[model samples]
Target: MSLHSVFERLAARPWLAAFVFGAASALALPPVYALPVLLLTIPGLLTLLGRAKGWRQAAWIGAWFGFGHQLVGLYWVTHAILTDVAKWFWLVPLAAPGLALPMGLYSILPALVAWRLAPGWPRVLGFAGAWVLAELLRGWAFTGFPWNLMGTAWAFAPLPMQPAALIGAFGLSFFTILLAGLPLLGARRAFGTGGAILAVWMGYGAWRLQGLPPQGTGAQLVLVQGNVRQDLKWDPSHRAAIFQRYVALTSQGAAAAVAEHPEAPVLVVWPETASPFLLAQDPEAIRIATEALPPRGLLLAGTVRAEWGPDGRANALANSLVVLDADGQRHGLYDKSYLVPFGEFMPFGGLLPIRLAAGGMDFSAGPGPSTLPLPGGLPAPGPLICYEVIFPGEVVGAERPGWLLNVTNDAWFGNSAGPYQHLASARMRAVEEGLPMVRAAQTGISAVFDRAGREVARLGLGETGVLRAELPAAGPPTLFGRWGRWIPGGILILSLAVALLLGWRRPSQV
Candidate 1:
C-alpha cells in the first residue's frame, strides 16, 4: 500500500480524521507536551484540506480539527462549570461544544483562505499563514482568548522556546505551523528541509541558553498560595475562613523573613480576588491585614475595590490588587485591565443566557499594563491580574517596571491542565519582557520565574503553601520587547511572498 492510499482512506472520513489528529496534537500542550505529535497532525490536516470537495468543506474540516484541538486542550473550562454543578449542570453538555464551535471558527476561516490560493507548498504555507492568522485573530477578536496556542507546546522545554525572546510567541507559532506542515510533501526534499529547520530551531535555542549567564541571585519575595476551593469561595459562610487563611499565610511569610533578613522589605503576593470583602469599604479586613504585615514589608493582595456612588451604591467595582504597608494603609492599587469577556463581563452580556463572576453588576476594567509603586516607592512592579499575564508585548507598557507580578484565581479551573498552561504563558512573558515574574495563584502552582524563563522556585498544584524565593533578576531588553508584533508580522508577509513566488500547484490527493 502506498502513502496515497493510506491517506485517501483516512481522508474519506474527514471529520473523524481531523478530530483524532487535532486531539492528538493537543497532547503537545502543557502537562502532556507530546511535541512530536505536531509533525503528524499538521500533515494530516493538510491532507484533509487538499482532498476537500470545496472551500466550504475545507472550512468545515479545519473547524472540526480545531474543535477537537480546543475540546481537549481546554477541557478545564468545564471544570469551572463543574464548580457550581447545581446551577450550571445544564451547561456541562453544551459548554465544551459551544465554546469549541466559535473558537474553531477561527481555524475554519483561515483554512478556507489557504485552500483558495492554488496548492502544493503554496497551499502548505497558506495553511500555516491562515492558521497563525486565525490564532492571532482569535486572541484579538472577542476580547481575545489566546489559550493553548501552538507555540505554547514548547513551554515545558526551554530549548525550542528560547527564540521566543526575539520573535515573541506568535513568531514561534508561525515557524511551528510552517515547519510542521513541510513534511506533508512526503518527498526527500521536503524531509531534508523540515529536518534542517528543526535543527536550526533547536540550535538557536541552545545558543540562546548558552548565552545566559549563570543564574544570579534575586530579590526577596513571599508568595501566598491559599488553596481556596472555587465552589466554597463565594459562599458567605466561607468568606471569613478565606480571609483568615491569606492573613495567616502573610504572617507566616513575614515571620520567616524576619528571621532571615530582619531589616529588609519582603514583598508579599496573593492570588486574584483572594479577599472576598469590599476591601476599601471594610475596616475589619484592614485591621486584620495590618496586624500581619512586618516592618519594612509590603503586602500585595487581590481584593475587590468598590467605588461608591453618591447615592450610596457601588458606582463601579474593580478586581484589584491592593498594596498595603504595615499599618495596612492603601499604598497602591492596580486593577485588572484585560477582563475576560464571559468570565469577567459577558459580550452582548444582557442578551446572553450566562453571566459569570457572581450575579452582580459588571466589574469595571482598570487601566492596566500599568506599574505599581512599591511600599517605599521602589522601581515598581508591573501588575498582571489573572488572565492578563497571557499577553506577550502588552504586559509591559511605556514605563517599564523593575519586575512583574501576576495575581490569578485558577481555582475556578480546579486541579487541571489550566493552571499549568497559565504558568507556561507567564514564563513566556518573562522571557519576552526580560523581567522576572512573581505568580501568585489561589489553589497552588505559585511560582517565581527569572527573566530567562527558568523556574527559580515553585509550589505545586492543589497544595497549600507559601513559596519563599528571591525574585530573580531581569535580563537586558529582549528583541520581542523592543520590536513587539512586527517580528511575527514580517514572518507572515514573508511566508505569503514565498508561497506566491514558488507558484501554487494542486498537491497530490494522496
Candidate 2:
C-alpha cells in the first residue's frame, strides 16, 4: 500500500496512530538512538496535520502525537516511582500520563498554528519553528522539565551536537524538526536539504574539535561511584556502610591515580549524598573521610548543607557540593540552584518546618553558578549538583569555571535508561559550554567528558567503581556561552513568525 493511503487510514483515528508516531520518536533518544526513524514518523505527522479540517482537529492530532512522544520518552519516571512502590505504586500509571498531558500540550499549540497558516515549505518551516517554541516554553514554564528536546536525537552522533555550541539545544531542535518535516517534500528535496544540513553540521564539529590540545589540562580527578540503592540510601542503619564504601573507593582511586600521574594533583569525588549524615556537623565522619585523602589532595563531594537559624534551630537546607581540604575542614560549598520541582522542593505541596534534616524534608533551591575555590591557584571547577548540568548557559556564571563538576544521585532511576538519558544531557552541557565535565553519580553511569563531549572515562549503571582520569581542559568559551541561549532560540522564533505570516497569506490545499 502507498504511504499516503496508510497515513490517511491511520489519520482517521489520529489519537492512537499519532501515539505510535510519538513512541517511535523515543527511539531517536539515547540508548536507542535510531534517529532515522524520525524521517518516517514526522513526515507522516505533518501530512496528517496537513489533512486536518480545523484548528481544533489539528490540535487534537498534535496533542495525541505529543502525548505518545512524551509518554514513551518519559516512561523512566515510572521506574523511579516503582523503586519505592510501597508508597508510590498507585502513582506509577498516573506518573506517565500526568506528566505527558502537560508536556503534550506543548505540541498542541504549534501543530494547530502551523496547520492554519502553513503549507508546503512554509508549513515545514512553521512546524519546525513551532516545535522549538514549544520546547522553549516547556523549558521555562512552571518550573521547567525540558527532558527530551528534538535536538537530543543527534546526541548519539557527536558531530551534530557541536551545533549546540553555536545555537543552544533549542536551535538544534528547530533544525531537527525542520529536517524531519522536509521528507514531506518528496525524496529529492528531502535528501538534498537533509544532506546539506548534515554536511554543514559535520564541518562545524570538525572545525571545533580539530587541533584541540591532546594533553590533559593538569587537573586529574577520581570520580567515586557508590552503587547505593534508593531504598537503603537513606536508612540510618546503612549510612555507616555507605560512607565506608565511598571512602574506601576514594582512598584506592586517589592512590592509584597519584601513582600513575605522580606529578598531577589528584582530587577525590563522591556522588550526590554519598555521605548521608552531615559530614560538616559530625567530626567523626569528617575524620574518616579525610583519612582517605592524600596530604595535599582535595575531596569534592555532594551532601546536604543546613543553615542554622540564629535561635540554634536549622532553617534552610541545600543540596550542595562541598569541597574539603586534606584536614577534612570545608573549603567551599556550591549549592544546587535549579532544584527539581517535586524531588527537591514540593511544588504546590505545602511547606513544612526543618527541625532535624534527618527526616524526610524537601531542599530549598540554592544560589547557582557558585564556583568553589580549589587548592591550587588553578582554574576553579564549578559544581553542578544533579540536574543543574542539564541547563545550558546557566552552567557558567560571570566567572566561567575551568570545568563542570557534575555530581548526581541517579539511584532513584535505578538501572534503567534514566541514567543513560541523564548522562546524555551532561555530555550536551559539555559541548554547549565548551567545558569538560566530570560527573559522579550514585548507582551508575558516572563519566568524564571533554569540551567536545567525548567520553574520556565512564562507569556504567549499578557498577561500584571510581573513574580516574585527567580532566580535559575547557575550550574557548562557546558561542552558546558567549551569546547566551536565547540568541539561537530567538533566531528560530523569528523564522517561525515569518513562516506563520507567509502561511497566513496563502491557504494550504489538502
| Model 2 RMSD vs true structure | 2.5
Model 1 spans with C-alpha error above 4 angstroms: 1-7, 117-119, 214-218, 505-510
State the lDDT of candidate 1 residue by residue for 1-510, as single tens digits. 996786677788998888888888899889888877888888888777777888678878888888889888888888888888888898888887788778877888666756665656787887777677777788788788888878887888667788899988888888788877777676785779878988988898888778885354434689999898888889999999989998898889878977887766778888888888876558888888768878777778888888988899887888998888787788788888898766777778468868656856788998768887775555488999999988767899788888889999998788889999999999888878888878999987898887878788899999897899876766789999998877877777787778767755444421
Cα lDDT tens digits for candidate 2, 1-510:
997787778878877777889888888887788888988888878877777877788888899989998888887877777667777677878887988888988899778767776567878888787787788778778877778777777777567788898888778888888888887788999899889988998898887777554457876789899899878888889988999998999899999988887777778888887898787666888889989988768888888878889998778888877888788788887778888766777666645321111355678777668677787776688888887777656778778888888899998777677788888888888888888888999988889888888878889898988998888888888788898767767877788778867766444352
Q: Which pairs, if any, clash in model 1? A: 139-144, 219-471
TM-score of each: 0.94, 0.95
Compared with the true structure, all predictions reach lDDT values of: 0.81, 0.81
